[model samples]
Target: MDEQPETVPEPAGGLDRRAELSEFLRTRRARLKPEDVGLPDFGRHRRVPGLRREELAQLAGVSVAYYTRLEQGNGRNVSAEVLDSIARALRLTDAEHAHLMHLAKPKQHKKKQAVRTQQVRGPLRQLLDMMDGFPAYVSGRRSDILAWNRMAAAVFGDWSELPPQDRNWARLVFLRPEYRDLYVEWDQKASDMVSYLRMDAGCHPDDPRLSALVGELSVKSEEFRQLWATHDVKEKGYGVKRIRHPLVGEMTLNFESFRLPDDSEQTLITYHAEPGSPSAEALRLLASWGADATRAGTGASSR
Candidate 1:
């Protein structure tokens, strides 16, 4: 019988840094072919897929022994120049290169330092509320829904109804079926969430809460497990989302994400529809209905 894959313990604090680095490098390497990198492919008798370590080393202008050590997860004492060379050799995207750097050279956190709760300033909260027609929300580390306006609550369901811990994109996307139905492209949404989490993990490998969240998601959602295994990383930025609102029917909205300058970890995201489009009309209708629902103490509850 085939051996079962090893499972990381649930609720553990943080990921194993070295292991994460190793797997990330391996996956990145596995996705490339020798021919893609101007290397000769000597028949199909290879024992493993993709370019071998030696081939990668040749492409990166590094010795096979040195590249092997780096691939084995010993990123210590490695310079940024070497990482740049390897990233170029791997043909990594900008986001992937940043993630690789984060994994290999994690920020040192004080073991005794307390975990501070993320809070949106009153001014920022007011800014969110002022964006009357746009659906706006502030998301902190781990995609926690920090603060949101009535429009956001209307478009994305009332986050106020959820407990603090449940106000996370990872939980809402993978654990709640309503969200799966909300996104027109559910698979893309799911993949995006996992990629965001992976990027966060690279930055905060010693974060206990993040580790617990990953562990919980891994145990509860097989889809999360598969995505997590891919070791993908993405930086949240401007994008378009096609949403199927229960009340509004179908609407395509463009979203912009801005990382707060004062606190880089907190991002302000807002959604808008093209002017005079059907989606814009739908959003206006939603805004009106949402205001009425809020006054009646019955917010837009997902079906």
Candidate 2:
């Protein structure tokens, strides 16, 4: 298994790890040839791991210097197309591919979920507040629910109802019995959450708060601890989740996430179905019930 460094707490010498990232990547690039990525081995002994920088540049249709700059972390304005090409040439696993992109731009700081960053500018908050009919939420790369529209909060659970610290959707899913009760496929969702968090952690191995969150969750939830050990990685953006909501029982919802053009780390997710569909109806009823329940000091009833 590949070992990633701890998310926070740098070497005592105050060296810039960001600068070292490029060097580390170059070392990873120096050792292989075409054969590693299905090019004939040609019976050669290579000094590097996967591919030579020049061979990878050729395979990825890039200049050796450009690839070298990227590996050295000196390149700027690295586009997604070039990143994708490099990903394929390196035969990066799903997690490694994402980590590569993250390493490509190590300067921008992504805050922990619930922590505000420049990504949630005032205009975006206004946009979320304006969408009152459907459930919508903004999530970061780590699937942290950065912000939620009123309906979204209601659909998941009353965010304001919980203490400020416990508002994270991912943490709630595994740690709180209330949110756990809503998932129709609880175990599946739990496993998905762990695997997804694991991948995010990999891409952000040097993020302090992310490490703390994982550590806290691991110690607090046995299931989380158990699931984290699997090392399974998945790339999921849009998916349907079945939930037996405390407000509405037995409903299926489809969600779509659109990446925010302005803030690269942000993606807004919306859930919807046809107007007359049963799921839609359930959603409407839940909204009203959750609204009413909020006033009555009773939890919303599950459909």
lDDT of each: 0.84, 0.64
In candidate 2, how many Å is residue 55 off? 20
Q: What is the TM-score of each candidate against the true structure?
A: 0.92, 0.61
Report clashes for each candidate as comma-separated counts: 0, 14
Which stretch of 10 consecutive residues in model 1 shows the poorest summed lDDT?
1-10
Taking every candidate in turn, the Cα RMSD to the unseen true structure, in Å, is: 6.8, 8.9
Q: Could you give candidate 2's per-residue lDDT for residues 226-295 as a string of tens digits?
A: 7765544555478888867655567788888787888756678888856798888977776676565333
lDDT, residue 62, model 1: 92
How accurate locally is residue 285 in candidate 2, as Cα lDDT from 0 to 100?
75
Query: Clashing residue pairs in candidate 1, if any?
Result: none
The worst-scoring run of ten residues by lDDT in candidate 2 lies at 1-10
